[model samples]
Target chain A: MKSVVVNNISKRYGSKKAVTTALRGISFEVDKGELFGIIGPDGAGKTSLFRILTTLLLAEEGTATVDGLDVVKAYKAIRQRVGYMPGRFSLYQDLTVKENLDFFATIFNTSVEENYDLIKDIYSQIEPFKDRKAGKLSGGMKQKLALSCALIHRPSVLFLDEPTTGVDAVSRKEFWEMLRKLKEQQITILVSTPYMDEASLCDKVALIQSGKILSIDTPEGVVRSFGKKIIAVKSSNMLNLLADLKKTELLEDAYPFGEYHHAVLKNESNEHELKNYLQQKGYPFEIKGTDPNIEDCFMALMKN
Target chain B: MRTLKFLLQKEFRQIFRDPSILRIIFIMPVIQLIVLPWAADYEIKNIKLAVIDHDRSDYSRSLTNKITASGYFILTDYTSSFEQTLGEIEHDKADIILEIPASFEKDLVKESESKLFMAVNAINGVKAGLGSSYLRSIIQDYNREVRTEWIQFPRFSPETSIEVTNSNWFNPSMNYKVFMVPGILVLLLTMVGSNLTAINIVKEKEIGTIEQINVTPVKKFHFILGKLIPFWVLGLLVFTIGFGIAWIVYGIYPAGSFLTIYLFAAVYLLAVLGLGLLISTYANNQQQAMLISFFLMMIFVLMGGLYTSIDSMPGWAQAITKANPVSYFIEVIRMVVLKGSGLADIKYQLLTILGFAVLLNGWAVVNYHKRS
Candidate 1:
């Protein structure tokens, strides 16, 4: 069963064409118990789309339904069925973690004791500081508290918007692990993030840029479709090597990737030929064939 | 109902845990309730008198003594010339001037009546009016004393049957403290209730928790009601504490039923909380919420007749008071506390507050955008 369906959603701001067409005709669906990811950079309409699906915002030109209920007409019902953790840590900072959880539970006309099992994994991590004000908690603890609050009512569908954007690497890893545990409970999840690596953990991924969906598929499938022989080159003189590689006769695309330079061949040139050409140009370098990653796929999609 | 109870419990815990906000909520009201009434009095005192007595006779000296002895007027300076006294009055060094005539003693002895020239600054109408009344009363007393002492009896004893009957309905002594304590309590509760809740919700919006709440199954009305319930109870708690303080420290106690007072306070408090929620819906940040709430609170307290009587104000100003929930609350509180009137006497004011509560909360729920 489809847990969520978004069709042709678009949003515009104002004159001076500050008007960013957020979610321009973006359409997608998530099956029950699937961990779906919307991967994009800043201003890619990730938050806007999440807000629309969560019933916090109304899309100018589209229809979205959660649990087969229209997001607009059935917002109240949608609210009951969906759990949302916004990008920012927005729990009551003045209240203790326990108080925040209890308050959220009560708002749903339920009690924390009634929903303890659902939030136990996330809540236990921050239970040591249950009496501490949420504002005084660490970022990771705040994230945990927020997640616990969102899950207190055991909604069938969960929406997490950039949940790990400002968290530490360890916390981010831990958060994704918790999401996996949640997935086992057969709850459909729609998670949005700007981090490309996190895309691989999702069952399916959508690569969005500038409010437009560039590609949507499994992470491995997206990388497989990159269809380019990528080479990583390194030399003592890195800057000159990058400039020289871009000017190379057989080099189709060359950009820095971390500590190495990533390049694609113009017409399927061999490594021996590339090494000989570089030697002739007096640019001593090492070259190695590398498999395309999610970042590489994103770059390839963006370039097209 | 259970949701409201839990939410209210959460709010109370939150408020108590935040030392800064808790301090502001409690300390501010106590200070304002104790100090504001003293600072807001319109009664004038300590007037500086500059007299230019051209007729420096015993009668003139006696009249001057009488003026100085009135306690309201302080004889600051004695001028020889009229110009000097006039300059003193213009410079604000003197409040009033008594000009005794040259034949003042002869006129009083020979003539049945004599007139003394008096000049007073009329810039501040209330002060000027009180000053004139004080001077006239002093002169009248002095004249009566002189007449009785010098002449055994008047040639013609006109049987002037002048009768003066005065009755003060509530607070017979007209103790300003009694009248003020209740009003200040109303003002204090309104300020703390509206400002704290307004800032609380707007802070959530700024921090992004409002979005989190928006996605939950919680109904919008439940969410808003849950948020305001805590502050509403806090307002009542503050009122009760203030009532106790007033009774113990200031010897001011409510003459009406405690239940009536609490009931009216609870209703009025809902209106205040509704106004706060309305403000929070409009404000995007904590700072904006605080500023707007403060502005509205100022207008509410001032127009609510906490400092001045609504009846004494102009018709237009009085008409505007009808829209202010604080005005109704203050009137209800005063009537219940001072006049010992029950719900029947304040039914109109209670209805006005009910209307405000509905109107404000209706606007809040309507204008509150689910998405931004």
Candidate 2:
């Protein structure tokens, strides 16, 4: 069964004449026990979409439901069952870790002793400094405490908006591992991130950009739908190669990536011809076929 | 109810943990209550009197002696020339001039009446009005003394004298401290109740914690009550401390029952805290909340009749005080503390504040949206 279903949701901000649209007819779903990711860059309306689902905001058009209840009509009921951690670290800074945890637990009509099993792994890591104020904790510890607070009630669905936006690599990796453990307990998860690589970690992802969804599929399925040949080209002089590749008629797109430029060709067979044109320009280079990652797919989708 | 309990626990913990808030909540009121009443005194004293006694007769000198002995004047300049005394007033040395006409003792005995021209420098209007009144009462006393002395023996003409005896009731001593302490205590309670709660929710908004609270299962009514109850309790705590200071430092014990004072305070805090929450709902950040609260507080305290009498105010200003919650509290506190007014005596004020409590809190609740 679907845990979350959003259909044709739209939202606008500001006054009448200077209105800025934050979301535009966006639609998607998250299955029960599925880890769903909404991947996009900043200002891509990820936070706005999470706020709509969490009932902190109202959508201008369309409808959303959480756990078989309408988000607009049954917001209070949804609030009980859905856990949301905003993009910002919003736990009471003056409160100790233990106090923050207990506060959330008691407010949800439970105690730390009751739901100790659900958050044991995450809470135990910060339990050593449970008496320390949350503001004094490291970024990774703060994120962990926030997640623990959001899950104190053992919510059926959790919405994390950019949980790893500022976390280090090791912590981000560990956070994903904890989410995997949570998924095992049959909890639906909807996470949004600006990091494209994190998209592959989700069971399914909807790539969004500028208030519009570019694509929605499994990570591998998204890569398979690229339907075009991409080549990685590098030379001693890498800067001029990108500009020169875009000038060529045989290339469909060219952009710099790390030390090499990933070039999309109009025809897969024209690779040899494109190489000859570069060689004629007195440039010695190396070219080979490369698998398009989620970012490359995102670029392809955004361009269209 | 459980959710509200947790909310209060969190709020009280946060309040106790912040040292600055604790100092503001406890120490500020103590200092203000001990210091403000003495400085905000309304009784005018030590008027500078310039006596231009043109008659320098035995009766005139005796009258000047009586005026100087009244303890309200300093007798700054005693010159015969009126122009010289006017110069004394110009230099701010004299606040009033008593010019006794040069009739000698013959005019009063022969005509049975005397005219005295007095000039008062009305620059500081209150001081001038008070100084002249004090002088007039002393002269009246001297006249009654002369009339009674002459009546001790039979005279050629018969005269009737009507004597008016005045007495001040309630505050018999006319003690400035007694009159001012209760009013100041009311103002302190208002400041603490409104200013603290005003910045409370807006602080959460600025720190981004309100979004977390908004997404919780807590209802809006519970959320607002959770915010209000702790501060409401603390506001009353401040009032208790202030009342203690008034008793200990100023020796002001309320003439009415303590129960009546607390009963009014309990309802009054709801109105003030409700106004604060209303401001918090409209303000997006702590800075905006502080600014709006400060602005409204200045208007409320100034027009609340603490420093000035509401009866003497202009018609429009008095109209504004009708809607001002602070004014009603100030009046009620004075009535209970100084005049020993009972609850039945202030039933109108109680119902009016109750109405304000409902209107303001109802408005704040309607504006405080859990989802937007």
Candidate 3:
């Protein structure tokens, strides 16, 4: 069943003369218990769309429903069904970690002891410093506490907006693992992040840019339809390699990818022939065929 | 109900954990309750006196001695001429000058009536009026003494027979401190409660915790009420400490039931906490919230009759004070503490504060948004 369905939602700030289109004709859906992801760079309207879904902001046009309740008309009901962890850590800093969790549970008309099982996994990591003020917790501990608080009431659908942006690599890995476990509890989750590596972890991914979705599909499906053979070639002079490849007639698209150059050539170009041509040009380099990952697919999609 | 309990618990924990905030909350009220009463007195003392004794008679000397012995006045200088006394008044060195005409003693014995010119500086009309009244009463008593010794009159004079008995109600001594301590306590509660709550919410907005709450199954009303409940209880707790100090140190216990004072204080706290929430809803950060709340609180406390009696103000000014919640709380507290008034005496104030609490919280909950 479709747990969340957003259709043609648009949001604009200020009047027409100076309006900022934060969300533009965006539409998507999440199935029951599916871990969906919105992958995009900063300022790509991820936060705005999350706000609309959480019922904190109303879309200017179209509609969104969370767990069969309308986003605007059924905001009160939606608030009770959805758990939202915004991009920033907004828990009461003055309150202790334990107090923060207790406060959130009470707001949902529940208790920490009642929902202890749900938050135990994440909350236990930060439990040692539960008495410490939320303001004093490390970035990773704060993320854990925030996630634990959001899950206290056991909402059906959880919306996490860039939950691991500032966290360390180990904590980020730990947080994603926690999400996978949460998926087992049969809770639908919609998470947004800027990290391409993290995108592969989600059941489905939506590549967004400039308030528009470039593509949405499973990580492998998006990579399978990358539609071009990619080549990585490096030379002793890397800058010269990029400038030289862009000037080549066979190369359709070429840009620097990490330490090597990822070059997408015309379909008709032969790999052996291209290597010979570069060899003749005295380009001391190693060339190899490369499989497309989500980052590669996103870059390809963004080009169009 | 559970939400309120949880919120109150969270508020108490927050207040207890922050030592600086706790100190400000508890110590501030006790210091203010003790110090403000002494500072906010209307009783004028140490008045500078300049005397120009033209007669320089033994009677005039005796009258000057009496004036000096009054203790209320400080005999700054003895002026030989009227011009010298006028110079002293012009220079602000003297508040009042007693001018005795020549042959003043002879006039008292022969003419039986002599006009004594008393020049009082009336720039501060209230103080000048009081000083003049004191001087007149002293002269009248001296004249009565002289008349009694010279004449073979009856023991009871007509003025003495028709005596006017005065009674000071509530605070019989008219102790300015007694009235001020309660008002200052109100001021402290409003400042600490409102500003602290305002900063708390705004800090969440700044740091992104509010977004986490928005995504939860927590209702907006629950979230808001949860947040305000803690601050409300803290305000009341602070008010209780203030009341305790008033009773212990100042011997100013409430005339009514202590429970009534606390119950009413709880309602008043809601109005104040709602105001803080309202401000936090509009503010994007802690600094902005603190600034706006500070400004609003200054206006509320100043106009709340903490320093002056609202009833004594002009009709229009008094009308303006009616809208201020602080004014009603101060009035109600004073009535309960000094007069021991019951519910009927403070019913109007109670209802008005309840109305303010509802309106402010309604506005806060409505304006409070989860989205940026």
The digit string of per-residue lDDT tens for model 1 on A202-275 reads 99999999989999899999988888788888998999888888888787788899899998876668667777
lDDT (10s digit) by residue, model 1, range B1-372 = 665566567667767777898787678767877787787666667877888888899988988988887778899788679988899889998888888888888898888677788899888788788988888888999999888878777676677667799999899988788878888898888887788888888977888877776776656776787788778877888888888878877888889999899988888888888888999988999889988987887788789898878999999999988888888888888888898999899888888888888998899999987665
- TM agreement with the true structure for every prediction: 0.88, 0.87, 0.80
How displaced is residue B346 in candidate 1, in Å? 2.8
Largest lDDT belongs to which candidate? 2
What's the ranking of the predictions by TM-score, best on top? 1, 2, 3
Ranking by lDDT: 2, 3, 1
Candidate with maximal DockQ = 2
State the fnat of candidate 2 relative to the true structure: 0.91
Residue range B92-193, candidate 3, lDDT tens digits: 999999888998999998999987898999998977998988888889988988887798876765454666899999999988777888888888888877
* DockQ values of all predictions: 0.63, 0.70, 0.46
Winner by lDDT between candidate 2 and candidate 1: 2
Candidate 2 clashes between residue pairs 3 or more apart in a chain or in different chains: none
Q: How well does model 1 score by local distance difference test? A: 0.85
Candidate 1 local lDDT, residue A262: 90
**In candidate 3, which residue ranges exceed 4 Å CA deviation?**
A15-17, A74-77, A94-133, A152-155, A180-186, A224-256, A260-293, B1-8, B48-68, B75-165, B188-207, B220-236, B254-284, B362-372
Q: Please tell me which model should have the higher TM-score, number 1 or number 2.
A: 1
